[model samples]
Target chain A: MKNKVIGNTDIVSGILDEQNEFTSVYSKGQAWLNELRIAGKNAFSEQGVPKFKDEEWKYTHIAKALGEHYHLPHTYSLPANQDLSNYKLLDANTVTLVYINGIPVPELSDKLISEGVTAAPASDVENSSEFKTFLGSVADISNHNFSACNTAFLNNPCIINVKAGVQSPKTIQIIHLLGTDDNDSMCFPRTLIHTEKGAYVEVVESYYSLPNSNQNFCAAVTEIIEEENSHVDYYKYEDVSDSTILTTNTYFKLQRDSRSESFTFSLNGKLIRNDLDIKLTAENGHAELHGIYLPNGQQHFDNHTLVDHISPHCYSNELYKGVMGGSAHAVFNGKVYVRRDAQKTNAYQSNNNILLSDEAQIDTKPQLEIYADDVKCSHGATTGQLDDDALFYLRARGIGENEARNLLVTAFSGEALNEIPNETLRDVFADKIHRKLSVMSH
Target chain B: MLNIKDLRAGIEGKEILKGLNLSVGEGEVHAIMGPNGSGKSTLANVLAGRDDYEVLGGSVLFEGNDLIEMSPEDRARAGIFLAFQYPVEIPGVSNANFLKTAVNEIRKSQGLEPLDSKDFLILMKEKLALVEMDKQMTSRAVNEGFSGGEKKRNEIFQMAMLQPKLAVLDETDSGLDIDALKIVANGVNALRDGKRSFVVITHYQRLLDYIVPDFVHVLYNGQIVKSGTKELALELEEKGYDWIKNEVAV
Candidate 1:
């Protein structure tokens, strides 16, 4: 892989070199990628990441997905009749960018220069040191070939930058509408949102695909930076009609006294995996992550998240809840790391899942890597069906069996759903999950 | 009207109710007094269509319909209400919301229009007054954070809200204080009507003093071996159950 360094810092040149693999994190990441390459698994290449037939990939295997061998078409018939109004984020009056089949949709995009917020392609920001140095630098993509493959291919990455001292609140929504030409061509989209000192901004990235294509790969990476006294709200929504393979990676870093909150809603995807990383670099930094994933009809969803605390007096909290049925499977792997000097760190993580079917399965692991003896760090994971006692009580009161189950599930996932503070948005996301449950009920 | 003939039921392999028979017409109140493990709760559960109990042989008719064959929800829709002895606690589900769901479900089953939120709240407030239930209990999760007396009062409160045709009070007096018992008994008394009947199951004769059962049946072991008027409850309270168990060993 040939990489160029346009900035004086040469961060990408240094990061892309094989010599950086000496670092432990980079080493493991590289080793993982090496194994993936050996296993002949590249997202687009003929030798893809090893199939789920292997034990490590058994829970979620792309090999079993239909049309896994389709070649990426240079151009897809960009469907023009598709609508984008429903993809708007709450309070997204500032600026928005809608991309369909890698092309921007004009009518629904928010390119308001009057608001002093500028949006452009990755190349526009590539000239700035802040963009190139920090873009793909922190992510140890050495062996996450899927990530590496994405970085190697995604040429039209979007850039959203919020400069220092800006306030009053601004938001941008990135909508990706899958077209029939990309019909079978996997798309690797990337985004970088930089919130400088005292700047407050929000980015809502939503994925909406057509009903015909279940044979596409959506491997994306989104990076965020919150400087001192800044606040960043990042939201991601995936509702792909249960026939897509989507893997999203999020990397975020918080400066001293900064705040970062992320909310994710997964309504429909045949196979979905989300990798989230939040690192606190200074004291008094706060990070919060909330997610809701509802999978039905033999769909598979996986979420891998890590929160790293390097400075003392930082706090990070996470809550992920899922509703699965119809032989649906959900796997969650959450890891929290506390450095030796990161004392007084308050970190907690909980992953709860409900099995709506006897065949529905869930595997959750909450990993804690704590080096600080004086810190309060705890993690918990539970997978169970709705309470039978509650079910009977509801039924005994005349609530039909199906309605009773839905109510219990809504209650179970209500904790995660509460993170959506906006009432209308919360209801919309919850309703989407409810609709998915109704489909599975049949 | 309700009737049970040669009823035998139990959980798992152990028989709880054996050869129990009784009948009650509309507007009548019957009391079943028994020692623990003598199948008192089992009878109430069977009547309410709880699946834990297996009715080996029995015939139960409610309003001339086969009550034994109906599902628990169907039985509830058919106007049978049981005040659970140890009411289960379901956290994260508010009492008011639960009751609303129940009320609407029963309404749907009976072909009656569901109560609007305003009317439902008004009805709940009215029922709360009868049981003297505090608002905190209804605002919190079902049976969660409730005291023993509050739980019993909640049972009566639900009975008030549902307005069932036949209500079975299962150990409603077991954990209540003098005041809670009075409030519970008074709530039941207020709901009594010419069209609805009640079956009160308890171990003590105190509750019977409040409701004043028209017929008293002494259940020893699995069978209702003795029957009498209200005087029978007074005699059981005096002699205790050991004497009857020994006397009725045959």
Candidate 2:
């Protein structure tokens, strides 16, 4: 039997038709911004929504998941006295910027009090030259359809700036909440972080749908530019409702001697896609990308990462792991490229997965392209079920079957979770993993 | 405390234990010596509830309960332990954490509160001394990168922690030096408090010299063809199992 496939035109036209109306309400009277939006819209229209025909989207049928119609979020308002305590992470040393439906809610967020740091909504700094110079420079909208779509409908984009030789006192957290009031709604959240030379900062972006929310779509794009000798840690935490479809594109451009580490944790969602791209443009630059995804119960999660070594003496490493159950499907595609000039480049990539049910599926690919003869590059991928010997070993020691499975899964995920630097965040992610695994075991 | 009558078991479709009978009372150590391919390890595994072994026809009674009807964890909670011949290596799980979870799970099954961290650590220290294990060893991954001797010692250390009523040693002395063997035997002897019973399955009589058993049984072609006191072990050591094959031929 042939499946009823949703055409790419139907998905693209639905969003393209809203461009004129969206610009009328959200435009800030900036000519450059309008040009950028128009460029983004044109790029999106030319490419359309990726379909099975697209080589990169061969395994993911995203267009079929998108219905014929979706309401674009125009107004933002939270319920009166809505308690947001459950969505907060790291209370003491964190500067939170809360967003409800892509609109910043300053009253619900913590102010940025650290010296030499500027964290605010884009509207507050629209006229600044730094915002214009670094906004669309890092992310490649011409190639990424989701990034282009997000840029076209961007609303109140968050901006964070760190000056030269300054170390931020606290971690910056961006929290986006999709409320339950709007069904079939979509929101585009954007963030730009630019760090000057010798700067050190940590940023975390988390996506969550309000409790009981359903059928919401979130497209988020974040661009980070690290100057020479800068150090940055970026984390993306996604735990939305089971009916939410999330697509995120994060780009990092590192200069000489700059180092960056990124962690993506995808715990719950209907269909999620994460695209992480890192470009080491100068010598002595390093990048580390790590991710852990646990998708169960018909959920779909895909992670695609690319590390480009453009200069000599650069290093890149990537490790991604997934635990799938209940007919869920997960995909991992990681690529490392070393140019001819990158003589001393060192790149390593690995992807591992465990399927808890017979119906569960995983597709993993690790690719490396090295032109430099002196470079050290290695890539490997593995997919299998939990070791029966390990399970029986635990059960033989009196651990219940459910608990035994939990321990082994926890151990499997701990390899990625241990990469988090903050202790509190590590514990929080550990708890989330434990809770999700317990639910899947049943 | 334990009884197996007419036990017939095998793996994958081939019968190993044709019909075996054995009974052990409390505080008794019974050593079973056999030639290669004998059913000594099969009996030990079947007793510990290893699912791979198919018990074609058998009845295992531990304090009047049908041992075969219970799950491995249930059997463990019901006071049964098996010191594996080749202990499985599990990475990313600390030895101490594994023991803590096992002890607490057993306690939970017996309607007892879980031990707190301080008390658990103290208990761990006490058990570590029984096998002469270093404190740092417990902090490492469970048996990962451990030597043969250390792995064997770890099994005995876990047995001490769980304190099961019936312990099945499956070739525990297969790969151990004399010094490590003596330490392991000493650890086992310390637990002999006239209550717990042990079934030691081995290929050689060297291990029995340290932890002297009260009864010696010869397992040949899946049956206990010979049974006697500790002298039987010495006789097998001196005359070899060929003598037993000759006797059974008659």
Task: Show how many residue pairs clash in every candidate, following the order shown.
Answer: 7, 0
> What TM-score is obtained for chain B in each of the predicted models?
0.97, 0.99
- The C-alpha stretches of model 2 lying farther than 4 A from their native spots are A1-7, A29-31
Error of 2 at A176 (Å): 0.8
Worst 10 residues of 2 chain B by lDDT: B42-51
Question: Can you list each candidate's DockQ?
Answer: 0.62, 0.80
lDDT of 1 by residue, A62-83 (tens): 5455342433434544346654
Model 2: colliding residue pairs: none
Per-residue lDDT over B58-142 for candidate 1, one digit per residue giving the tens place of the 0 to 100 score: 8999989999899889998999999989887887778999999899999988788999999998999889999888777788988
Judge candidate 1 against the unseen true structure and give its global Cα lDDT, from 0 to 1: 0.76
| Maximum-DockQ candidate | 2
DockQ of 2: 0.80
Error of 2 at B128 (Å): 1.4
